[model samples]
Target: MLCATFSQIEIRGKKGRTVPVLLTSEIESNIDLLLQHREMAGIHPENLYLLPRSNFNSKEPIRSTDVLRKYGKEANLCKAENITSTKLRKHIATISQVLNLSRHDLETMAEFMGHDIDIHRSIYRLPQETIQVVKMGRLLSAFDNGTIVQYRGLDEITNYLRFKGGLLTLVL
Candidate 1:
């Protein structure tokens, strides 16, 4: 996986929902470096594990929650409360709504987040303040300029977004 041009991991979250998460370039590089360090740490190919325990079988991962918490703390530069994985997931979800994604893109993103599209909309979409401050501002501007339309669904909103707000074009 380290030598590959791209890498992705399928994370089975709660409720048996699986999400294929693509690694960014920076994260991929870190993974490659980690694997190299793992080899240096005497974790042989016969018993391969990225985060292998020193005296335990290599087949099992080091499942200590503290490891996640440690990284969560480091990443929480703002010193926010309860910087857990769930917070990270929700942060990704809330911000993603403003991308003005097309219907297919939204579905793909929702599936990649290990939830149904409806769930994504109902629970993960940005709050009203964010929408009102950002997206709705653009909508209001377009409406004032007589460039808006009367659309009923997300797809129509996406079309309107294309001409008003810059839209996100996801390839993966």
Candidate 2:
């Protein structure tokens, strides 16, 4: 999109839900530069669509297929695989698993992702293999350090360590 403002965005998400999104500082700067260039190029501000149709009289948005071809060729990615917006979505989801966000942060992310908390937990959470490997490594480290506690269910540990308001105070 050529002229999208990056401060904040309100998008119609999956199932027509209105989702609010805020941009990072880097993205905001980039969008500001792009908008300034567009103004210098004499592109009229009356057109509201970020990716406007080429025809002056047309109000429709630019076709996605046209954008795909241009983007692929410019990035030299057309030969590797079919690159689409869907790939970008999955890429973000995959990398997000590594972030150590609180429960409230996870819920906010789920809303931005256009899904309920349950769907986010079941689908976007780290893969079982990754989780097991990381946890196993931590357990081994604790054992080696002689700090390992007796094996008990996660519920018992969480209940014992959780703050009075049910917030998890343990990190790791």
Best by lDDT: 1
lDDT of 1 by residue, 6-49 (tens): 56888667888777867778887887898878756656556655
User: What's model 1's overall lDDT?
Assistant: 0.67
- lDDT value for model 2: 0.63
Residue 113 of model 2, lDDT score: 70
- The CA lDDT of each predicted structure is 0.67, 0.63
The backbone clash count of each candidate, in order, is 0, 0
For model 1, which pairs clash? none
Over the stretch 74-96, how does candidate 2's per-residue lDDT look in tens digits? 88874734666556656666566
